[model samples]
Target: MRVTPQPVRRQVEERLREAIITSRFMPGEHLSDRMLGDVFGVSRGVIREAVRLLEAEGLIKVVPNRGPFVAFLSAAEATQVYEVRAVLEALAGQGFAERASTEEIAELREVFEELAATRPGTDRMVLLNLKRRFYGVMLRGCRNAYVARMLDQLLNRNSQLRATTLSDPKRLPQTIAEIRRIVEAIERRDPGAAWAACREHVHQAAQVALRILNQQARDEAAQGLEVALD
Candidate 1:
């Protein structure tokens, strides 16, 4: 477990953010202040302050009459995220190819191998952690602080919405192939190829994810129409 350093409130805030991202708290789930206070061993005031921080981050939704609930995005909102991510990650990939040292390139290759070895039935959290590690290497090796900062914001929200896409067994092989192209490009220090590969990877993931979200929306609409006819 990673220990968060801070005043009580920041620690609690990170705790809540991780929970929300991991689906431990879950989308649209009511967050009871009392329950959080008991669980975190903090006072209600501390919970409120922490929740307020996440509300500003767009992970928590606070309504006029209702208390805080985990925020769930519409498909349109998710589309914007993926579009932004493609450009940001592409830049990071190009930068890493141009600037990363030999060791950094090798480290990325090793991480890619681990990811490729993962079977379809592998644990969800494990895959997420590995993917995070892979991106961490790319960001630091890229040595661009500005791009890293922008990607961090999108990644926080994107992870929550990517659960369905990442878990699709049908996409696993394609994902590995896409990421392998990125690793190979970076290893060869081909900046343009790395950029294109990264952009294409995000494009493919967006397609799979958006398709699922749209289908779910259609299913819900059809269900509501049935109730109306009743």
Candidate 2:
């Protein structure tokens, strides 16, 4: 009854979390424990444990008698998330602007370079990982454990939306430009400017994501209508 390699459960949890956040496992899709166990090369027990982790993160839900399904974002939930992120990210920017050292600025620049080099149309999951690295520079620069903890959940969800937005060729330039402006404000040690820039960035991105999510819902609804008509 041993789950081979033991640590495979943790690996499976990470993989599933990535898949869910990147939209690879779309909302409302029920995850079959047996199929997932096979996919991860682990036991059903391991898959259950992995799902439990995601459920706790609010990225998945386990319904009684219905198994586990990927979590769907309500419009209200999405708006709240962006609102909270704006305040928290502004605080992070302020903290970073006030005390970010030259070394930290250079580190952030390096991450920005990495982000720029990443070509468009890359796998969403891979782009998310890179985006996390870019965000890591800002979070570390802020140097506040509480802010970091508050942002963890929001950041995970943001990365998913960011990836989807950036996937569109039309949005890529604006995304990069907005991020660059924030970086410039931070480098100048202008906390007010940094906060303003960061807030605008988050707000614009949120609008784009909301549009994308709404469009997806419409597409799904249309498909369901077609099925019904058939």
Candidate 3:
């Protein structure tokens, strides 16, 4: 059997998507096709194709004359994303609790333990990777193909918003505790409790993210007011 090579366009698109998701290319920052082509060692056409893919993923926006820029999420959009995520995640948790085998639960537990062992001052990237792995296990064990697919599409924006939420020094412990609660419910095979735990975790995280966004908006408004008065 011949092995199929991954498409160059898809490879470029994944790199660009990861860059945007990791905040390497910050939201609203312009992406130059020539510069990106140089950096990726690809042609302008390839870069453009990759960028259009990212645009479809909602990680980039193309302006007619201005080219493509990283997508920015407003507080309202973030709230809506998290609200939908809460429902989907709760469903996943419930499904996992109801269906996951003993071996699968053990695998998820191991991931959770690794996550819990992460120190407060550990690198954010490390924590993010562990969190991703934990959720990967959950998605696999949950046995809901449609829910997995839907959540996969939202993962990039979810990563962007999570960076903001997890940046708060006070939130790390709370996040750990929330995950612990969910895991405990799953371990007990309590679908209702697991669903509630998952929803509550997302709800609390949304509140933190919304608070930060509101504060930033207020600061921007005050600055504009000062400029007007002057």
For candidate 3, give the lDDT of residue 30: 91
lDDT of 2: 0.81
Candidate 2 lDDT by residue in tens digits, 38-132: 77788899899989987887888899998999887766678889999999988888888887788998888787777677666766566567667
Candidate 2 TM-score over all chains jointly = 0.85
Pairwise lDDT winner, candidates 2 and 3 = 3
lDDT of 3 by residue, 3-120 (tens): 9988988888888888887878988899998889987889999999999887887788899999999988788988888889999999999999999999999999999899788767
Candidate 1 lDDT trough over 10 residues, lowest sum: 158-167
Better of 1 and 2 by TM-score: 1
Residues 134-167, candidate 1: write the lDDT tens digits.
9999999999999998897778786865665666
Q: Estimate the overall C-alpha local distance difference test score of candidate 3.
A: 0.87
lDDT of each: 0.88, 0.81, 0.87
Clashes of 1: 0
Stretches of candidate 2 exceeding 4 Å from the true structure? 1-9, 117-126, 227-230
